[model samples]
Target: MKKRLKLNLQSRLQIKTVPSIRLANFIELPEKEFSRFIEAVENNPLFLKLANPLTPEERVIIPQKFPGTRFSPHCFLSLDEARLADASPINLSPVLERHHKAIKLIRKLGLDKFQKYFIERTSAVLPEDIARILRLKKSQVEAINELMNEVSIHSEFYARSSLGTGHKISYIKVAKIEFDKDKNPGITFFSPRHFIGRYKIDYEKVEQLKKRDFFLSEDIGKLNALFGKLELINRRKNILYQTILGIIEKQKIFFVSGNKDDMVCCLQKEIAHKLSVHPSLVCRAIYGKSLELPRGEEKPIKDFFLPKKEYIKRVILTLFKEHKKVLSDNQTAVELKKTFGISASRRAVSNYRRELNFPSSRKK
Candidate 1:
């Protein structure tokens, strides 16, 4: 009962896609296309016969399936005569072909290819694991890393609910810190703006295309796929933002002084819970993603994972410096739990102390 219809025509054409800003589903074709397609069917006898319009008061004749029976051609016009009275130019061959090709190419390839294409275009890799997955030659990866070194986007200072309304709100001033040509560090903040691609498309322009007389029928379905893909990319970018903001909000002291020592332990699960997403999603978002910090540097999101051994070392060092006597590793473990909330086994504490040449007990 359904088959492809072949039509040959020549006309200037362009494609427009309408997608919801908040949702990643559905694409709708403009009304003008429907009107034009109706006109095209009227002008072509073959298509008109296939459409099979029925007349009022005309008795329906069911066609016989017996061989050698011939039936009169039939045509249908769902739209009223008044609606089709307005003549519209309908040409869809070119537009349908283009949309079909693009959709076909997208479906034929996997996400990895597209990810690599974007990475190549944006040069936006930061995590070592992502680099390994990219499988780029060592030279190519290093070359891209060193090629373009400049601040691309800028952001403004702002404040939010401090991650919890109960907690005091905090102001954020992101600055690009770079040393002057003479080697003196200078701080600069860029104009505040939403990150690019968040809401770049103008729906009004797409609406304007509705006034046209015709569009490709395939465009609706094809563009839906295209827009869905675009929305996914936007989602990834959003995840990166959420990840960074959550980290900065939780570990305020580290970013304040720009010192690793100030970094408190931040777990991936903690961030995932705060963002209300899966821990695996948080991991995927941070994989190969880096945020351009106010310090005019790019840092991997994974760097927020406080190194356990290093943290233990710092905690032990603090305990040793503040105490008058060397405490047993067991005592050190207990003190670590009490003071820094770090749970460390006695053997682990002893090994770290011995590795650092700190005696098991303080010099009496």
Candidate 2:
């Protein structure tokens, strides 16, 4: 290999977030000489006001409790144990029961209803669909499902989501969703562990009584559901991010890949739809959001989300939708090149097409 010539020497700018500084320099100076200098130089009213003379509340060092040699009880005893002395009598059995109930309900009811409940709190189904699934009268299903919702009223929990992390957990409770579009439709009961007639309890009042030693067992349930919601949200976010990033990764070979990826092209709407979520939610995942990897670094979960190449996906989708015949990569490439002003060859088109999951337009 030939030796490379040296380029220009330059220094990169380093942004200092915080460096050393003194309180005396910021506020009142310890020395009179410095105070006089501040008074003379800072002519602006705000600065002058902030200087020695014209200020209203003069900075005074309040006498702090002198660092005593004597140790407090907390120093010798465990803080948690000390606090527990003042805490309410806790019956953990209730909390554990509520937790298990929530888990059982999700497992028994099936993921569809549980997932629906997680998101919207209610999912409507027609009478016939209900009958087909549950083998019950539409009326019975509606009553049963509505009864489940009443049994698991959690909308109230979401109303107070701004509380502490624990409190916020209490705010988004999970309940089995039950709705009948007809006069009465079949309802779903997910939890296999039925303490009472196919229900963890007959009603919320009875259920809420099992306080789990907390303010309300309902809140405890909410807390548990919130964890599941957060996990699901994280998973969805990662999947969306990966898809966007993956497209960009493969787009470099678009010329050779477009015609080969019909199924991949079908996912454009899916990817584009996710990028539009509130940005704060997106960043929320980035800060300390992590998962246990097979490699075990516990990498941030946000790394899964990636920016996708929107333009390329749009082109692929358009080509797939427009092409009626089962055209092979060469024919599809010709059509795309001729009509779309996209300069790509048959092989490249084939690769891209396969990636997009677009079925080949060729006759079977």
Top of the candidates by TM-score: 1
- For each candidate in turn, the TM-score is 0.40, 0.20
Checking candidate 1 for backbone clashes, the offending pairs are: 52-75, 52-76, 53-75, 53-76, 156-192, 175-294, 326-362
lDDT of 2 by residue, 1-364 (tens): 0222111111001101111132112212221232233223323332222122221232111111111111111111111223333322343233324344333434454545533433222222343454456454565544443333332322221111122243212221111112134312111222111101110112343234344342243444453333232223223323223333333333323322333342223233333334433343334323332322222222233333433333444565676667644467777667767876666677777677667776666634
lDDT of 1 by residue, 1-364 (tens): 1121111111001011212233122111121232232234223432222122232112111111111111110101111223223331233233324344332332343444433432222223333333465664544444332211111110111111122223242222222233344433322322111122122223343344334422245543444444344344344434444555566555566655677667776788876565444566667555543334445444556767776787788778778878966789989999999988889999999898987788757554
Highest lDDT against the true fold, candidate: 1
Sequence-dependent TM-score of model 2: 0.20
Error of 2 at 242 (Å): 21
What's the true lDDT of residue 93 in model 2?
34
